[model samples]
Every structure is written in structure tokens, then in C-alpha cells.
Target chain A: MGITSRTENQGRTIFINVTERFDFNQHAVFRKLLNDAKDGCEFVVDLTAAEYMDSSALGLLLLLRKKAGNNRVELRYVKPSAIEKVVSASNFSRLFDCKAVSPL
Target chain B: MSDQCNTDGSLNLVFKPVSRRLALVVDDEPINCVIMQSILEKMGFETAIAHDGYEAIEAFELLAPDFVFMDVIMPHMDGREAARCIKSMTSGRFTPIVFLTALDDPEEVHACIEAGGDDYLSKPVDPRLLRTRIYSLERIRSLYQKLSRQHDELLFKIAEEQENEALANRVFLHAVSAHNEPISGLDSYSRPASCFSGDLVLSCRLGQGGIRVMLGDFTGHGLAAAIGALPTSELFHAMTRQGRSIPELLTELNHKLCRILPDDRFMAAVLIDIDPVKGEFCYWSGGMPPFVYKSKDQLIYHSSSGLPLGILENYDFVSEVGSGRLTDIERILLMSDGLLDVRNQEGATFSSCGFKDLMDSWASNDGFFSALDERLDQHCQNRLPDDDVTLVSIDLEKALAVLNVSSDQSADLSPEPEGWEWALASGGGYLLDHSEVITALTDTKYLQDWPAEQAERLQTLFGELYNNAIEHGLFGLDSSLKSTPDGFHLYYEKRQALFDDPPPGQIRIQMTFLPRQQGGCLRLVVQDPGKGYDLTRLSELEQHDDPSRFWGRGMQLVRSLADNLIIHPPGNRVEAELRW
Candidate 1:
């Protein structure tokens, strides 16, 4: 599994999705997605399908926050419990708005 | 060739001659050799003739010809055999061989090719087909030469780059680990995913009879991640040598990294300082996994509550230090997150629960590190880890022994300089912000030859005296405010507020070193401008039996560390004499 992204709301918002493993392998693709997004657009990272994440992934999120501005970036549906532990451990909540939807 | 006319000129044609190429003709029949030689000479190549296989090899070696025409049938040796011999003599250089065959059989043509004949012609070879074959083979030979030359250049470049990387790695390793002290109780293992490790572990002997260890993991693995470690290690060793506390060291490290590193990069680290004399352990963790302290009966984990270094600026950075009694801990284990993130073949991680289970299964502290190493290897099935892995374990009793022996080493008894005096006056703002002044005061060129322990003690003595004058005399902050935990926080807060816009006052410091019969003595004097307090209160507080009270401990420490102590009238001046 890998990273994918799409635009919505007439290109006003971009939704980037990460699946399975999220680590350094995704660095170039992630930065390219951030770079391609329209300026001043809201960014939402969907990690619902992610099973593992590393510190490099944390660094990528920090980079995204820096580009998207603090209020415009949000982490949606951080799930599988394990990834959420990393999110909290790294104190990402202080830097971005994170929303986790419980799996049924 | 082209003809051109100049201004006064007649028509002129120019010809540039090409270098002649040599060809060899091998055949037992004189008629076949003559026919091949005539055609090759018509194509502007000079020719050499050989009778058979043996003669062909000799002629090929002697002439170093550009190409060869071989006849299939011969007297002593066949044309195919001669072609094979000539091919062997050419080695890596390409020399085309065309066989002259009368037989129309496909098997004979295949045999000619098997003998290294590049192509073949009929008994009466046609000049036009011979020219086409020569032109195409010459094109292939030139291409091969170009490719071989480029291959050699690429190999040379790669070798040069590898040598440079090896040299840089050597210098980097020395800078990172040369200052590390070999303490008895400290054991560590580091395995980088690549040639250079992003993880760094440093251990330094604190000046005040203890040890300080730091384990830091940068953003990624390999050379890019390893770059930040140079500054971190340099700062850690330099500040620890000055006997600075963990918070002060962390503050400076954070500020330095923040100014240098990019926004996406930061270091996750855990630092532990163990004071053997006080029987205490203090640590600061930032964005790293929890460090575990294991006793015989219980285990304690200190988790990180601060952001990783280089992420927050100096004004927003807060170092949260946790402390506990050394008696309660049998061993302290610290690791990078990479250890827990190790994955098996099935993609299952060696999570924290696995670590806990392993710790629980250990019956005793003996060989714990070895056991953990074996377990990790078994879990990963000998595959190289995806991230750099580091683990450190410190045994309390052995660490204390190392510290005791180090402090007990007798100072060098060499004669000292006759005498020297240094003095400085600084405003309250400068004193509050720069603690390096304490180090500078004690680290004069004259004292450079003193034993490390003596120099460290003088630094501590000066530091305590300097903090007293600024915190109590200049700022007028009450020591009673530091008795309770909340008040301790408040006291620092008030101190920081006062430091933002320091009050108008100055403190004077003077130090004098004098050589004595046995060793030497240092006289330190610090004067402030505040009104004096009751001198009797100091002795009363010293007699009090409350060990946990934070107030009055600085004065007690000063008194114990100095051989003679005096407070001048008005309580604004303090004098201490330390003898070696």
C-alpha cells in the first residue's frame, strides 16, 4: 500500500490518503503532493488505512503543517489504535487538529 | 574534396589523406591468398599473407593487423583453425575475420562462425560485399572502444567517492566518541541501517563525581541524519565538562540546533545524569520512548513530555527533568524508538508489550543486555533492521564505584605558579542569562594545569556564590518561596520575569590563587548591593534537620565545599577559601 491524494470542493481542499506503511519511502511523493496543492487550500490527511508509521512520517506531517499553515491542516480518521499511539506520543495534537473515527 | 575561389584566386581542390589499415590473409592456397590480398588492397588496406594456422598466429602477432581473410581448406592446417588461432591472439581488441569458403553447406558456414569468423565469403570473393562487411564491423569495433573507455572512467569515479566517504566516516566517529569516558557500569550497542548511523550515544563523567549519558536519534538514517550529531556531541561534552546541569545543557543544545537545522529535522533524545555522592538520578526525555528503571521488585518508566529538540525556539522550550533515588534502581535502560519499531518477516513489530514481556521474564540483572540483544536478533530473523537501533544499560552500584575511584585519585602534587588574581563586575541581567561566566571565572589560563576535579569544584563554588548574589541580594527573591514544590516553580517564574527586565544593580567578583607548602588555596569574594540579612539565620538553618527543604541548601553546599567561609557585615559580601 502507498500514498494517494485527490482534490475536492472545486480544488479548494485537498485530501491526501496514506495506506498500510507510512515511512521515509513516501517522502518524495508526499512533498510533491503538498507542492501541487493550490495555495491557501485546506489540507486533510486521511490515515484510516495505515497500519504502521515511523518518525520520518512524523517529520513529513510537520513539513505539511509548515506548508499548509497551522489551521488549514487536519488529520482525519487516524485509526488502528497503533498509529494513534504514535500520533499522541509525538505530541502531534499540539501542532495539528486530529480527528479519529472509531472503526465498526 | 571541394574547390573554392579566393578574391584574386584560381579554383583549388584539397585532399586530406586517411591513415592506412593493415589486413592479414591466411590460406594454404597461394591463389586464394593472392585474390584476398588484391581485394583488401583495393579497399585501401595493406595486407600480410600467412600459409596456415601456425603461420597465421605468428603473422597476426607480428603485424597487429586490423582484419583477416581466412580460407576454409588448407594443407597442414584448416582455415577455421587459423581463424581460431588469430582470434585468440587479438585478446580484448576486436579484429574481424572473414572466411573464404567454396562449400555451399550451412554446416560449413556454422563451423566457420564457431571458430570466431565474424563473416564468410565465397571462393571468388566479391569486392562490393567485402567492403560492406568491413565497414559494418569497423563501426561495431569503434562503439565497443567507446563503451569500454566510459566503463573505466565510471569505475574510477565510484572508487574515489567510496574512499572519501570512508575518510569522512573516520573523522566523524572520532569527533563523536573521542570524548566519551569508559565508565564501568555503562554498556551500549548501536547498529546503523546504513554506513553512517543516525543514532548517537554519548557518556561523559560529570565533574561532581557522577556520570551523564545521552542517547539521541535524528530524523532519518544514514549520512543526512548523522550530520546533526556533530554539533550535539560537541555541545554535550563541552557543557558537561563545565559541570553544567542537564537543563542548562539542554537549553543551549536546543537553541543551537534550532538555529542550524531545517524545520523538518529534529532530534529525539533522552539524557540521564546520575550523582553518586547524592545517591540520586535525574533525567530529561524529549520525544523519545520512555526510559525504564528496574529494581529487584519494581520497575518505573519515565515518559517524555517535551517536544523534540530543534522544533521549538528557545523562548518556548521547557526541559522537564525527573529525579529519583539511586538506591531504588538496579539498572537503567534507555533506547531509541528504532528498537521498538523493528519488524519481523510477517510485518509484526516488536512493540512495547514485547519489551515489557521480555523484561518480566528476566530472572535477574545478570546478562540482561545480552539477552535483549539475542531476543531482538531472533525476532528479526537476522534481517538488517529498517532503522538504526541503540540500547544502553547502566548498573547503579558499578557506576557509583567508578565515580568513587575517579574522585579519589590524588591530585597532581607539582608546584603551581606563585600567584594570580582575576576580577570581574557584571550587571544582574548578564549574570542571570550567562552561566558560562562561572566557567570562565574558574577556567583561567593559570588554572589550566590544575587537576580536573579541583577545577570543577572551583566552578561549582563560584556558581553557587554567583547565583546567591543575583537571586537573593540583587533580585531580593525570598529563599522561603522555594520550600514547597509549587513555590519552587513560582520562584523560578519570578526569577525569569525579573530577568526579562533586570533591576538596576551590579555584583562584583574577585578570585585569588596562591601557592602553599602542600598544595594551593583559592580565595573567592562576591559582593552585592542589597541590604544585609541576619547572619545567625544561616547557622540556625544549617542545624535544622529537614533534608527535603530546598531553601538554605545552596549555602550549606557552599559551606561544605569550602574550607573557610565568611559573611561580611551588611550580608552583601561573601568570602570563601578552598584548599587543595
Candidate 2:
């Protein structure tokens, strides 16, 4: 499962809604989302529905940060899945700001 | 005439060239020039002629001959003087010159050679010797050509080997990543050798009890070192899945390596188990470096393994290499010799002392694993390491839960719960080690409160649990054997006999923890394949609560401490549960 889309305006903030599993199988999906980032806005990655993430997926995230370049596109991880412990082990919190979003 | 093989494995040309380059025949007499020219043409070489020594020198420079045949008897200048001048001009270059002389005296012949003539040919030159000399020189040139080609090939091969080694190193890293697919709570970094460095690290679960880590460095490098890794990894993961004891696993490993390893090599390794719930650590080492346990204070405990594998044919490893107790919030440090031997820019070794101090400094401030890795990289000056380096740190704080409760909550809560997860952890006959049993208990949710006191009780419970399962369940020992002194002696002998011929039956121990409205409850059931026990006397004795009841002490002690103890069995199973 994957969420390949741009950030939509949610009231005062613009956030990207992720509604599927992120893995190595979704190479094209991740590549497109990274290429299609809009300019001049803080973006929150809403991971409220993602159930799994592999190392390749994590590696894609790092590549996305590099691709963002001077665009100053800050990625915020919101609502990480309980089953996915890779986030804590890799210590992504130190590299990126994470804020949990309540379940709908 | 045809010539055979030269000394340097080459053949001399038989069919001479028809249009061979011309040679100048220089002499004072026109008659001698004519004779030489006719001979040269017959030998398939073109000829040029000069009458006097002065004319010969002028003609020599204008038309450079491949070789020259000059006569000593000349007008303006002798053959000696002209030869000296020609030799000087062509010094270091391969230009053959033979002297043509009518005089038969030794003195004249010596003078010809001293004047830089390569060889002396009498007034009647031998055509056979001329052909042979040209063939020999050509052979020298061809030999040099072959040598130059081989030299170029050798250089190419070396470069190809280096490129292949780089690619092999990348593949080894991929293999490690595949083995350790998804890691949590830590970021692992490894750098492998291109050719083959036997040093490797694996972090995973050991029997679902706790996180298990293994750091191994084989005897040699390259393909020889990596062969053991395949089998070692297979055994490590297989035993971990079956929940086999490290001692038992080590025994299997030892036997396997002894049979497989070649005469010259062996494996040195370390195995570590860390329980997230109990925050306890257990480890076994086999001739590996001592793993350091770091505390908030400057205290460090070193855990070392016993022996390397394949040393003995039939070896029995002691389950515990060292004391296997660990505290919560502690950091365990593991490393290979690569870290200790890392040389600085000034060529000084980064000794163990330096490593300990570095770790202590970081651990004091509760440094994360990433920070520690970064500090190590900085210390090495960001240069490539000469030897392999691997380090793993497990934070005890993250592994344990520290919470306090008020009186109302404390009163309502019980140490053991009612219905939790029921698991049957059994495998190969090697789980007798106290450390293995402790780790298994600590991994379960029921034993999360594995304080020093609770551990002591668990030690007793395990001893009884194991003995009862082995003796009564597998060996079918009667409880009435303790009734008389004679019976006790006979029972001891019978136990030994049973061990000698051990039975094959599974002992299933199930434990559950349930959080009830009033308090939590605990349930334990140990089932065997044997017939059910006679519980009529035990049920009657439970009402009296006598301290000195001979037949029921084991069950009585369990009943008194536990809120509920029931014996439901035909003859083989025991089910018991305790609340608080």
C-alpha cells in the first residue's frame, strides 16, 4: 500500500496524507512523491494509516530530504503505526521532528 | 642451412629474405669489393662498394648499412681507424661489424678484434657462420618482445583482482543486511572486507526471549574465513527460533565446527542475550574479547567466553561463561580486536584503556548509540579503518519500566496476573543452564518484576520445575521413594540409571498472567506425556495445613505462597496458579 500525492491545505496547515504501507515494492510511488514536492510550505506526512516500513523505505526518506534541496520543505512525521518499530530504532526523531496525530 | 631451437625456446628463420637490406663492402682494392658484392648478393643481401678508407667513411655515413665487412689493407686510412670511428658513432646500438683479412697471423687478428670489430672473417668468408650470427641476434630481440608482453599482462591481472575485491566487499555487506532484515531500537553499521574478512555482527532475538547479539571473528581472511559463517549463522538462527539454550547451541556449534573446519583454522565468537522486560543480560564467549557493561557511574564489568570452537572433538561447554546478572538502564558494550588495535595518524594503537574511557564518558551523559558511533568515527579521523571495527550497545533504561503506585492502586494490584500468553518453550536437552532458564523467564510478561528476591524464587521454581519434569514426567519416579532411608538410596541410584538411558517425552510448561478487577492472577501448568499422578492424599492434606507433611511439601509450599493451587491430573500433569 502507498500514498503518492502532494500536500493538501488543511485549514491553517498543508499536510500530505499517507494511507498505505511503505516498502521497497513501492519504488516508483516514493520516487514520484519526492519529485512532486511544492515550494515554500511546511509539510506534515500524515502516517496515520501506514502499517509497515522497511529499510529501503527509510532510505527513500533520506533521498527525499536530499531531493527537497533548498526548497526548505520540512517533513513532519505524524501518527506512526504501533507495529512499525523501525522509526524508534533508526532514531528518525533526532533527524526529523515527529508529532503524533490522533486516530479518526 | 636450417637451424634448430635457440636457447630461449625460439626458432631461427630458415628461408632468408630475398631483398635483405644492403651492407657496404669497403676495401682499397676494387677486386675485393667485387668478390664481397657477389657473395652478399648470393646470400640474399644487396651490396654497396667503396675503394679506399676515406671513401668508405664518406659512403658509410651516407648509406648506413645494417652490417659492414671492412678490410685492414687501405690507402688513405687503415681499416682499424675507420672501424674505431664507426663503432664510436653506433655505440650502445646493435650494429655487427666483421673484419675481412688476408693475413693469417694471430697478431693481426687480435688487432682486428681490439679495433671494435665484432668478429673476424678470413679473406674467404664462411656464409654459414654469417647466417647463424644474424639468426642469433634476431632471437635476442624476439625474447625481449615476449618478456615485455608478459609484464603487461601481470599488471592487468593485479588491477582486476583489486576491482573484484571491492565488489566482493559490497556483496558481503548485502548478505548481512539480508540476515538482519528489520532492526529496532538501534542503528547498526558494518563495513566488510572486499576479499573476505571473517569479522561479522548479528543482532536479533534469541528464542523470542530477548534480543541476542553475536560478534564473531574468524581465524583468517577472505574466502577461508567466510565459510564458517554460513553454518554458524544457520545454527544461531535455528536454535534461536526453537528457544535452545546457548550452552546447548554452543555444544552443537562446537561439534559442527570440529567436524567441518580444516586443520589450520577455528572460530572465536561471543553470544549475548538481553531481555527487554526483565532488563537482564546473559552471555557466552569462546576465546573472544571481553564485552564491557557500562553503568552511569565509572563502573565496568567485563564478560568473557570460555573457549573457541573446534578445539576439542567431544567438548561439553559450561552454560554460564561468567556471572549473567545485569541491571536495568545499563549499557552493554561489545567489540572485536579491530577497535583495540586501531592506529592513530601518529601510528599509535588505540588500546582497550582508551576505548573504556571513551565509552564511560559518553555513557555518563546517557549518550545514544548513534552519538557513540559518531564519536568513534571522529576519533579515527574519518579515515578508512585498517582492521574491521564492530560495536553494539544496549541501553538497560530503554529495556526496563520504572513506575511507582499509591496505596489504593498497590493494594488492588497483584504481582502475578491470571490469564496472559501461554507458551511451551522446549527444545534440545541443553536448557539446564540457570542463565538460559532465567532469560526465558525474564522474557515472559509474568516475570517482568524479576527483582533479586523474585529471581531467587524463580531459581528454586526452575530447579523444581526442571527436576520434576525430568524425573517424574520423563523417568516416572514415585513420590513414595522418599518414605524410607533404604528407599532414598535406591531412588538416587534409579535417577542415575534413568539419566544414563534418558526417555524421550515432551514436558510442556504453560504460564498465564491476567489483570483482574480486584488484583492480577497467575496460572502455571506443567504437562508431561506420562500417566496422571495420584492426587487423593494431597487433596486431603491441604485442609490440615500441616508443616511436616512428608508427601506434600513441594505442593504445600507452592499452595501456601500461591492464592490457589489445584492438582488436576490422571498421573502426568500439574496445574497451579497464584494471585499476588
Candidate 3:
């Protein structure tokens, strides 16, 4: 599923909740979700429940970083699946956010 | 009892009928029955005689007589009882039975039907109608047998096809089972399609220098995909053992596949070479995912695949396989598209952002594979994967180093004109004493090879070339430039001033070497970039009239010095032969 919402309580804290599964069929839906959520909100995506993610999923997150004005989303991945790990390894993590904790 | 034969009393034991038919005559009074039998036999049926109904029943059971005329008034057993027994024997099947009645009573005819009779006639029965009915019943029986046989064969064929399909599925499962395991690579974990995986991962050492690693994903799964694996595996194993370069192996694979693979089939692949000693890695990508390398500080580099092979004929991948040197403790990760394109239960990707954070946090504490497994497991929540997945990783520090010494040295030297090999033989421990020889040597035709403005660039080049000839070629010196410092500078300065002017110098040069079609040679020849010492002296030097003259010494040193050398037609010019 895809992560959708983010809100900043203060300059120090941010929260991001899941929105939808970022898959081939839902690519368009996921894109709209990201666009709507990225209106100057600082958040970290909580992925404790998402079971699978693909390259396109990674692409959308990259788009989120760009949309967050100065790429300051400060998004952190809480948990990632086996497939997510592979997508994460592809320089995306190096580009913006860092993996936080693997809840599994 | 009467034995009669027609009207002529010739033993008269048999009755003959005018028509070609047979009739059975059964009677206690043989004489009366015989006459009746003859009368019936005259009509059309063949006839036989029986004294009692018991004998008649026996004949009917054995011969299956189509038409029977029985006497209701028979000895021992009655005709009505015999008819009932015969009817019971042929129940539910067609057999026309006719009964003979002495009395024309409707009640008697009804009693005969109850005895399983089709029709009854008076004592004087009309035989024509009986013959017609028997013929019609036989025709229907033959038609029923033909239709039932055809239906049984069709059912058998459909069952056989179902069994074969099941057998094929079993074989496919076995092939994929071999690769199924708990993986522990950069991104540890595996996902296959519908339990029948088509993507393949292979690792083997290539020759003595490099380790060959590859991941291949076919277009479709099951039988459509299985066809490509046999060739893919065979070529990969063979080429890796032969130490063929990735390009060569890829080209070979493409050729073989194009010849046999169906039009719809194709394969996307990524090939890698990791050298532990050189700390270098080479990658030849066809159409896989973007392979990445993570630095100790978390900096990332991406190497994406080119177009897949076997998609087009004679398509060449010309660029050098991309390569990089690894830093200490760095990690290199490779993956296929399946992992990147996965969607979760809500139809959304795990996303690259979430993936990045997960990796960066765990990158330091755990191995890449374990961390990958833990992170993905957390994100997916133990859901099944929808696509095929593969991941590969190599430790940066463990990867070997590749040094381009030939290119480095060539950059320092200069190129000579076509078709020349100039060998310089320098002497003395100090280069100062050899100034005149250096100046005279530089004045030869060789200095004229390059452009005038590039003279300074030629200084270090000529210095190396001259020193190499004098120390290595002449004195058999084994000192390498990398190892020697003292001789290097002296050699540099001597070479600097030599190319300052354009002059004529009869420097004799020669060459002797083997040349190849695809081979080339580069030479750094040094000579005075100036006019010759004198035309007469040059002519005399060319003539070599005085072998002992020091003025012609440069000529002699160069002439016998190399494989082939020529002072240009202009007295001041010198040229070296480079087979390349």
C-alpha cells in the first residue's frame, strides 16, 4: 500500500500515514495521493503494515521529496518488506531519507 | 407315419415346395403333417419336421428361427406354452412370431398375443406378409451397433491430454525448486511467479581473473519460459569457465537464442565481474534494474542496464562495460525489476522513500541481506510476492583493483610518424656529459615527426625513449621508471633541449620486428628539431664513408639501432617506423 498523509506538529516532529498500495494498476491513484499530501507537511512514512513495494513505489517517494518544496520531507521508513529492501537499495535511501527501524 | 416326396413316389420321405423356402412340420400323425408341410413349403420358406413341441423348442433355441408356425394341438407340450417360453427368452428384443390357429376366434387370437405372438393366421396362413416383416426387423439391428462404438473413442482422447498437462506442471516445479532457498544477499529474500519461477541467478569464477555473476529474467513463465533456461544456463556455465568477456558471452548467447527462440520470447539480463584483488568491478547490463553501490557514508551510485539482447539481430553493445573501484567496507547491490515493481495490498508501492530510510538506518549494524530481509518483512507484513525477485551483493573492500599502467605511460610519451620504430641508446651515469650526443641525436629526422608547437610535450617522451634505448637496449639496464628517481630527471633535461631547434642530422636508425593486422606500435623518437650539420657531411654520413667519424655516430647508432629507420629525403628529417 501507499503512504498518503503527513503533518508537522512542530519544527521537530512529523507524522506520515499510509494511503494506498503503490502498484502498476494504482500508479495514477498513488501519484494523486502523494500530490495531495505533500503540501508543505514534514512527515516520516510509517510502513509497518505495507507488505510489498516495487520500483514504481520508489519512484513515487522520490517524487514526494521533490514536491515537498526544498526536498525537506524528512521522510523515514519505519518498516520495509523484502521487496521494499531491494527497491530501497537502489540509491533512493541515499538520495533523501534514511531507513529508521525494521519493525519485523 | 408317411414319408413323402412331392407327387412322384421316390421314397417320399421329404416334401418339396415349388417356392424357395423352408417349413418345419411337427405332428404325431406324420402323413397328415407331411402334406401340410409340402403345401407351406410350396409357398416360399424352407421346412423342417418335428414330432413334438419339445423338439420344436430345441430347434428354435439353437437356430433362432425367424418364423415359426406352431400347432396349438401338439403332443406333450402345447404350442401356446412353447410360444410363451420362446417369447420369454427373447424379451425386449425384436423377433416376429406367427401362430397357426384352427379356429377363427378373436378370443383365441388374443390368447396367442398374451403368449408373446406378433400376429396369428388361420390354418391356411398367407406366407407373403410374414417374409416382408422379418426383413424389416433385421435392418434396424445393424444400424444400432455402428453408432455406439464412435462415442467411446472420443472420451478416451480428452482424458489423455489432461494427464499430460499434469506431468508438465510437475517438471516445471522441480526445476524452480533447486533455486528456492533463504537468500542472504544485498536485499535478501526471494519472490517467484505463481510458484514457477523463470528468473535465474548464477555465480561462477571466470578464468583466473574475474568472478562471473548474472541474473536473467525471461519474458513469460512455465513452458514458455522453461524453453529459454536450458540454453541460458548452458551458455552461462560454459562461457564463464572459458573466461569469455561479458560482451563475447552475451553476443554468443544472443546468437544462439535468436536461432531457436520463438518470435515472442526474449530475455533481460545483467552480468557482473568482481575482482577481489584489483578492487574493480565490470558490469554488462541488458534490461534489468538499476544496480546500486552504497558508500561507507551512504552515498549511492546507480548503473542501469542497456537494451536486452536477442531482441534485435546484430545489435552490438559497444561501450566498455561500466566499472568502478570500491572503497573499504562499501557495499554493492544488484536487483531485478520484480522487487522494485511490487505493490502492496492497497495497490500502492512500498515506495523508494520508505525503502531508503530503512536501509540507511540498518546499513551499519547488520549485513545488507539480513537487514533487507528484516525491512521487507516488516513492510510487507508477511504477504506473498506477486512477481519474481533476485538480489546480489559484493563487499567493496573485497573487490579487486584494476590499474591501467599501459594507458598512463602512453600519456606521458608522444606518437611518432607512421611506419617507424626509433630506439634511443643513452650512456653515462650522469646526463650532463652526453649533451653533444643528445643534441646531435635530437637533430636527426625523428624530431620532425610531430608538430612544431608540441616540442615541449615531446621532452619527457623523448627522454624516456632515449634512456630506454641507452640503458635497456644498449647497456641492458633493468631499472624501471617507477623504481628509479636519480636517472629520471637527468634523462628529462637532456630530452628537453634536444627538440628546441630544427636541424639536419644524419641519424641512422633501423628496425626489426613482427607486425600483426589488429596490432599497433607507438614510439617516442627524439632528434634535434633543426637543420642538418652540413649537406656534404650529411651526404658523407649517409654514405658512411668514415665509419669511425663521431659526426656519423648518431646515424650508425640509429641505423643498426632499430628494426627500420629512414632519414627523410630532406637531409634534416628523421622518421621512425611504428607498425601500429
lDDT of 2 by residue, B74-120 (tens): 88888888888888877435456778888878999899889987777
In candidate 3, what are the lDDT values of residues B421-460, reduced to their tens digit? 3232222112322344435435555445544433333343
lDDT of each: 0.76, 0.60, 0.53
Deviation in Å, model 3, residue B400 alpha carbon: 7.2
Error of 2 at B527 (Å): 33
DockQ of candidate 2 compared with the true complex: 0.01
Which of the two candidates, 1 or 2, achieves a greater TM-score against the reference?
1
Local accuracy of candidate 1 as per-residue lDDT tens digits, B1-580 = 1111222132111111143378888888788778887767765677899988778888888888888888788778887887877777777678888888898689999999999999888767777667667667776777877887888898998776666556546655798878788876688977666566678899998875578999998886555665788889999999999988888889998998887877788898899998755567888888888888886687777887767888767534334788888776678888888788888888777874367766664426657767777888888888988888888888665665331212221123222446665555556344433355654543446577777888778878888888888888889999989988999999999998886776867676666777787678988888887886567897799899688787888888898889999999988899999898
List ranges where model 1 is wrong by over 4 Å.
A9-12, A19-21, A34-42, A50-52, A76-78, A81-89, A101-104, B1-161, B276-279, B314-319, B343-363, B372-383, B402-580
Best by DockQ: 1
Off by over 4 Å in 3: A1-104, B1-188, B327-329, B365-367, B381-383, B396-580
